[model samples]
Target: MALTLALESSSSSRGEGGGDGHGSCRPRESMFEKVVTPSDVGKLNRLVVPKHLAEKHLPLPGAAARAGGTVLCFHDARGGEAAWRFRYSYWSSSQSYVMTKGWSRYVRDKRLAAGDTVSFYRDGARLFIDCRRIRRAGVVPAVPPRQPQQAFFFHNQQQAAVQPQQHLVVAPRVVVVDDEVEEARRRRCLRLFGVNLELELRAEPLLLDLQL
Candidate 1:
């Protein structure tokens, strides 16, 4: 599968993209179209994919609390111990715990390897990832270079939390988002990159009792 793009979401439709070859899009219906104009619709929220992670990063729904914000981040078993770097703008409070991108310093921090579920905590402005309990999936996420054709390490976990107390989405992936981020943020994510990807609007997990 040539290392297909990875996607994470909780709502909306469309799973991760490996390139369907056939472009499948179900447009807006009549009345809904009347109320929402193309321009206004054009200004709707879109997922922000990093330039390096565009085709590779999938916009999926966030996972549930019981399951922890964890998903089987698909990867090509091709590269061994190689650093796969991608870019991202957002990360759930927990996923943002580890260092997104930096030369070093996170030596004490636990890396987000495959199979390992990460727990996050927000002490102040920054979100801290739990470095102790992550069970590595044995595959390492490779980092990219700025010299072009190289891999990037910055991948974003969209900002949307889900309420475990309510009905779950049941979808493999989901997103946790802030109310302030509307379509403007979405367009910027696309404009900042260059390709259009699927987006699902899901709830973020409540930030209460998160002492961990």
Candidate 2:
């Protein structure tokens, strides 16, 4: 009985130690953090990167505007694991703001064009920006001017002396009728008949001679 009690006590101690070791071996938390959605910002506010922003040096809004900082980290939309750094400076030309030094490189890498939008949000001390590309209007292909189409009119052989064969070139004209006016006219014409009948019904009008 003494030997059996000793064996049971040893087994219990081993089981408790194994459980504690397993708990301690758990994986650490992820480095990447969750970003706040644009909707959460009142009025869905975001800064739109102008055409000039990519070309000339410009001052971007900083922490006051929720975009200013000395260093910003850009996370890949595919996955937040990949990140790029952008160094910026805060200064006051007219007012205090943050200007990104290496923003041009990021713009070139993303192939961002004028009218594209970008928004920035903060995760603790880190600043992150999201980009949205705008589709530019394509250049319209030039259409060559159409040459006039000559329509030949031939006269009867017997009447060739009085009337000669002639060529006529007709210029195309587009006529636009006001829908409101046309509808009003149609209503008036229907009311004149004293019965509601389809406009296809055509009747002759009577004429009287008034000669004294």
Candidate 3:
């Protein structure tokens, strides 16, 4: 395949060109799409292209091409060019073609994972790549049930000392918060015992203990 890549910089998806007053039409463009595999996003950091797709869309590997694979520039959906050039090469051991050298960073920046879909569109000299993330069920959590107000204990050492027989109690303050976050904060307060109360209450822990 003889591929020349360039940014379209235009909004037109379908366009016409090359007319010599004769009845002739340009060949239809081809698109390559594949599902992302674990190795594509894993430590291997390379994408495996099928033999047919590689032959039909990528540069054929020769002695010089084998030594150093051709660098292909692919554009993203937002018309952003990739920071690194992707190397396209043919592997003899597995008799497969693969994309390497910059693939790792591409997947990382795109946040692509296994089971996602990646596609390549070849329009004349321009090439575009897009990613579609896999959809998972139950990703959005259901709304939690409403609960009573949250309370944090303030251990008054002075009050406890004054009335050793009676347990010291402090008035509870109300704050609107998620149940899980509030429960975690309550348990943390119980463990710290006002040591870090200012984090949740936004006031001096010792001062609040004394005032209450």
Candidate 4:
């Protein structure tokens, strides 16, 4: 008596034993014979690089791009909602090349100075595209923007103005975990150790905006 067996083959090539007899479940994506060309690279930039003027430079005849000391004047992802400003001297010193095909939200709102650099990365023909500010746009925020230290001061004043939590003593007692085994496990998992622990942390939540 003979038993029949069924197998799933994912190899790109069709050969003996259904999969070159290698008995490997090749990645399905590899099996897909998608052809990549200059046009395809351009499409990737049009997709992930976000909608901008510089993306127009994609399909740049390469799979990727790399630029040195490119100033990130503003990036929706790189900077917070506010498009921060940077020192002109920093970028000027690099003498870097800027990508010109696309302009992201940063370029539009920050009104970056001409000579600002932004490099675009993509697939296929367009990999690294340079962006530069041929002209300034929008109202430049300030030579050096204000810091959150002001907010910290305001919060401190308001907090001080209000009466502090009344100091009170409570009877010390042991926590009972009669039927909370799972709860104990969750508490144990979430507990950060030593340096990871904080109580009413005084640390600022975000980075100092570096426009340099």
TM-score of each: 0.16, 0.30, 0.50, 0.16
Question: What is the lDDT, from 0 to 100, of the residue 125 in candidate 3?
Answer: 71
> Which segments of model 2 are wrong by more than 4 Å?
1-69, 123-126, 136-212
Reference-based TM-score, model 4: 0.16
The prediction achieving the highest lDDT against the true structure is 3
lDDT (tens digit, per residue) of candidate 1 on 1-212: 13222332222432331122222111111110011122221222221223233223232233432333222221111222333232223345533311123212122122222122222222222222222212222222132101122222223423232334534332222222232223433321111111112234335433323211
lDDT of 4: 0.25
Tens-digit per-residue lDDT, 110-204, candidate 2: 43323344444333444344454332232211211111212221223123211112221223321111112223234211110011111321243
For 79-113, candidate 4 gives per-residue lDDT tens digits of: 12343332111122433223332332223332222
Residue-level lDDT tens digits of model 3 in 1-212: 53333334432443222211122122324367777776787778799998898888875658745786678877553343343468888788888888898887677665555656677755677666666544433222122111111323234422333222223244432121122233323321211221111123333332224222
**Global lDDT scores for all candidate models:** 0.24, 0.30, 0.50, 0.25
Provide the global lDDT of candidate 3 against the true structure.
Answer: 0.50
Question: Which is superior by TM-score, 1 or 3?
Answer: 3
- Per-residue error (Å), model 4, residue 97: 17
Q: Which stretches of candidate 4 lie over 4 Å from their true place?
A: 1-57, 60-106, 122-212
Q: Candidate 2: worst 10 consecutive residues by lDDT? A: 188-197
Q: Which of the two candidates, 1 or 3, achieves a greater lDDT against the reference? A: 3
